[model samples]
Target: MDTQQLEKETLEKIDQIVKNNPVVIFMKGTPQMPSCGFSARAAQALIDTGENFGFVNVLADPAVFEFLPKYQDWPTFPQIYIDGELVGGCDITLELAESGELKKMMAEANAKHAQQDA
Candidate 1:
């Protein structure tokens, strides 16, 4: 498939992901067993926030690896998205945690999702 088709497919999958799960994490692996150090750290940050989230293992899909970078325009793995928006990788998550912003964002996200569910 062409780049356009691949991009479209990747984004559509991502959209479905975020829509189905309130908090979606497109990281290296499952939250229980992250494939990389960055992914593990990102998961930890999310855990610290005390919110449950969904995770997609890009390592499990070759197409996802080939197409995800183009979708996010980010040359890295362990990408985290909140409410369907990219929130950078492990370093950004660590920074947010150190500043206590990660927890705050998680709380806000949880509240927003709770409102939607209600």
Candidate 2:
């Protein structure tokens, strides 16, 4: 596929991901093995919430890596999406985690997913 086509496809994939998953992190790697420090901390915050979240390894997908910033107008890694909304990056996530808001948001999203599934 051409670069533009690939970017389109990757952007679609990103949209589907954030929309379908209540909580998702677009980071450098998986939660289990984050490639960047920012990614590691952000993933850890989600993990600490004791809620399951989806993730995309931007490093593994060059199209996504290149297109993601433009997708949200956020120039950073470890972008968190909650209920299909951009929730910012590492520091913001850390603040949310510290404030105990992250857990609540995750729980609400999980519950919403559960209700939809049921």
Candidate 3:
């Protein structure tokens, strides 16, 4: 496939991943070893919520890293998605964490998915 086709496929893959997971973070690295400080903080906030979340290491995949911003017109790393929605980057995540809203959102998403599974 051509480069354009590859990028389109990558975008589609990103969409599918987001849809399939209740909470997902697309960051510079893994939550366990974030390469960016912003990503580290963002991932930690999610972790502090005591909720399970999926993470995609943008650094591990160039196509994904390049195409992610286009996914939602978001021009940043450590993009967090909740219930297939863009919840912004590190700063917003931190704010949510401080307000305890992150935990609630995560809980609700998990419950929603769990109900579907059941």
Best by lDDT: 3
lDDT for each candidate structure? 0.81, 0.94, 0.96
Which stretch of 10 consecutive residues in model 1 shows the poorest summed lDDT?
14-23
Model 3 regions more than 4 Å off? none
Per-residue CA lDDT of candidate 1, range 32-109, in tens?
898889999999889888887888899897778777787778889888777767888889989988999878877777
Provide the lowest-lDDT 10-residue window in model 2: 1-10
Q: Write the per-residue lDDT of candidate 3 for residues 33-105, one digit (tens) a residue.
A: 9999999999999999999899999999999999999999999998999999999999999999999999999
Shift in Å, residue 27, candidate 3? 0.5
Candidate 1 local distance difference test against the native: 0.81
Give model 3's TM-score versus the native structure.
0.98
Relative to the true structure, candidate 2 reaches a TM of: 0.95
Between candidates 1 and 3, the one scoring higher on lDDT is 3
User: With candidate 3 superimposed using the best TM-score fit, by how many Å does residue 20's alpha carbon deviate from the native?
Assistant: 0.4
Candidate 2 residue-wise lDDT at 5: 89
Write model 2 residue lDDT over 10-112, tens digit each, in one string: 8898899888999999999899989999999999999999998999999998888999998899999989999889999999999999999999999999899
Query: What does the lDDT read for residue 23 in candidate 3?
Result: 97
TM-scores of the models, in the order given: 0.87, 0.95, 0.98
Best by TM-score: 3
